[model samples]
Target: MGAADARLPVLEGGPLLRKAFPDHWSFLLGELALYSLLVLILTGVWLTLFFTPEMREVVYTGPYAPLRGVRMSAAFDSTLRISFDVRGGLLMRQAHHWAALVFVAAIGVHLLRIFFTGAFRRPRELNWVIGLTLFVVTLAEGFAGYSLPDDLLSGTGLRIAQGIMTSIPVVGTYVAFLVFGGAFPGHDIITRLYPVHILLLPGALIALLTVHLILVFHLKHTQWRGPGHTVRNAVGKPFFPQFTASSGGLSVAVAGVLVLLSALAQVNPVWNYGPYRPDLVSTGSQPDWYVGFLEGALRLVPAWETHVAGHTLMWNVLLPAVVLPALLFAVLYAYPFVEQRITGEWRDEQHFCDRPRERPVRTGLGVAGTVWYGVLLLAGGNDVIAQTFRISVNALTWVLRVALIVAPVLAFVVTRWLCRALTEAERHRLAEGVSTGEIRQNVTGGYESDHEPVTSFRPGAPRRQLTAARTGTPSRTPHEPEHPDR
Candidate 1:
């Protein structure tokens, strides 16, 4: 209605609509994470409207008649009512859970892609740290989100968390009491953690994500391959029509899959387990799949006694809960610096993805992480293992203890060797074209094979200048252009 309004740049219809996108499947992982986040926000908003975050105990009169006489926290009761009473609430809750799982998973894969490719080399180092922080926050969010349910499984997870916190030598108990507002799952704990799960962490993650994107845009994307391979140096398309359109399609696809899985594959059937009872310990208690490694570590530790400075040491509890978490965080935070030191190189720019084999050390670490996580995951199932083998839990724990020490070393060594082999293979292929498995017979009947040719260009090259050609210029005669054919 106003001239100023008319002068404003048009939105929803822009030049970006005409942009082209790259058709690489690898780029879809980030889009999957973004789409999952979108779904999470939508579902979270719906759930917040129906559920109360209060910690006060209340009598339940929900559709689930079995819970009618039971007294539970308002948060837990509201969650159950939402799932059974409110139409579509269960679907939304499941979607939220699935989204959280996907978000954590995508970020892990994304970081791995960056690491193997040397994308985190220079300016992107900050982004790597941001990613790592996001991962930590996501795990915390998952823990809090599940704990809000106040079911036996969730309660057990909370107990483990509390124990881990209180395992610190000097200030552990105080921190635990502070965090939980008293003993494990104190009266106010849910009320305290609800905001952290639903609001604070989400808000912080969004802010960090925004910053991550801005930095990515400012720096442009890291790409693979040579310069002459494309008209441009970038790997993917612009973030306008092409990239955005493809991303939208992929997001829809991923969201659809998550929704389908959520609908069909249920998680955390808290109702069956009922409310948290300190006296009741459920058989086969397990944390979420993502946190299983930590749980496994706790299971693997041997019961031990030590004395230091007139203080009795409970090594089993302290090592898994306090020392382990500290070590994990420290290693993650120190990775960028460690890598920088190892490579002893600095650059203003880095690529987005690198071949994993090219970065042997990083690949080795990844393998080592996998092995470590795998061993711990097995440790978490120590009971099952003992039952299956008809062996003692103590013996199982001891075996895992030894594995915890040795498995990582073996993994790192094997991974490093595999990477070296792959690198050598790549070099061989680069030196001689990739093998097609066809043998050629030479003129004299000897067998020969064609190989890849070496690259003509160096690692980096300078631009060449263009000049005009002289018409009818006498070509330089062989050996005597300056001597005039003498």
Candidate 2:
């Protein structure tokens, strides 16, 4: 048998694969995530074959040679080799980075869709937790992957992490030292993160994803629009050859596009930055966007010092790095419960979904979260903003602090209003015909078409059902000829 034929599944057919699935645009979010993961896997496989996950000092012998014999991590040298020497290696590396970026973005947007639509309610809470875990793991995976390069950027990030760790009281320094395997410029640091990047985090992510998919299959998908939103049944098609084929096709298409982009465009050109050097501080360096919020927080926090028992404490560092993140994650983990309590809904009676407008408070919280993240993202480029706008760094930090508080409230209020307006508009449309733009004179010489009533039905119900019967036709009498079946 031919290789392709040899892989065919042997099965007794129950239904035609082509006819079993729905082609809905909303389903594309999951497809995008899946596609990015496929690209990640492909690029990662190639990278793993060439990479040396070691932290030993090495002499760089690649295209870039500003500091050839400076003694950098083996992982960094291997990355340099991959970028400069191996055929198509740079493209693969860029593709891998882009894939990780896209994967995280897709999952985030997907979560927003779930939250706004109330898909995280009730039976789906576990799935929501799974998704949140996946998101956290994805972030960790990205951080680990970025750090494995041991570039100036990665080094800076490690320093930030160490700072965050050491910001804790008492045991903070010990924990940081333990994690990094010594002090700053610790030799064992990259070595520790190497396995975490390629193995540990990825394994955990895969396992969580497996569980996530199993739960999704069990619960089916939550849908939008029509009476379907009110009903518990999946308002969609079966998951068979149709969804599989289309999703597969989309994955291939997205991967192909990313591959082309990676090959044609440049990203993360760390060669220009040379290797990680402790003594030399590079200007205009920044962490990746995903980690920018913490950086922003660090910048905004006012410097302070306190002393107790002959030990000094820096409240600025502690608040931003340790307390802030703890607060954020604690809120995230507590949401399902907090919301359930506030809404006075018991776990057993909860549905798998909610319409965005149905839960105004939750939707508002989501919008506020986005605004908070966005402010931090902008703050990540604070230097750029200061340079561009001719402002001082301190002034910019103050502005960001004000914005961090105000922006989310504004965003929440505006989003809540807009969602309500849209819901009302939908309700109005269902109750009445499209509002006519023009008026016409009737045969009786009164304003006609504009004032004409197309149908009269109660608002918030399907139009097609009651359009003809006003309040809907009464059930036929038992003696009626139409009631023969009854």
Per-residue C-alpha lDDT of model 2 across residues 1-486, encoded as one tens digit per residue = 233334555322332222223245765886798779878988998999999877788887666768566677788899988988999889999999889888998998988887776667666778888888898889889988988888887787888888878878888999999998888878888778878887898889889988987776656665543332333444455455456666778888898889888988888887877678776655777776777888888887778879889776879899987888779877877687777666655334343345566556677889899899889888878998888889897788888989999999998898888777766776665556544567778788998545224453322233333333343443221221110000
Taking the tens digit of each residue's C-alpha lDDT, what string does model 1 give over 1-486? Answer: 134335646422333333333456665666677888888888888888987877788888877877788988787888898889888988888988988889888987887677666677676788878888888888888888888888777888888788777667778889999987888768888888878988899998898899887776655566554322232345557666567767778878988998998899997777777777777766878777778888898877777768789666778888876788779888977887777665664532444345666667788888888788788988988897888889998888888889988999999898888878866665554545434457899999899876533442111211100000112222221221111000
Tell me the whole-model lDDT of each prediction, alpha carbons only: 0.72, 0.74
Which candidate should be chosen as best, given lDDT against the real structure? Answer: 2
Candidate 2 CA-lDDT value: 0.74
- For model 2, what is the error of residue 12's alpha carbon versus the real structure, in angstroms, after optimal superposition? 12
C-alpha lDDT (0 to 100) for residue 460 of candidate 2: 27
- Which regions of candidate 2 fall more than 4 Å away from where they truly are? 1-23, 65-70, 227-232, 347-355, 424-486
TM accuracy, model 1:
0.84
Worst 10 residues of 1 by lDDT: 461-470
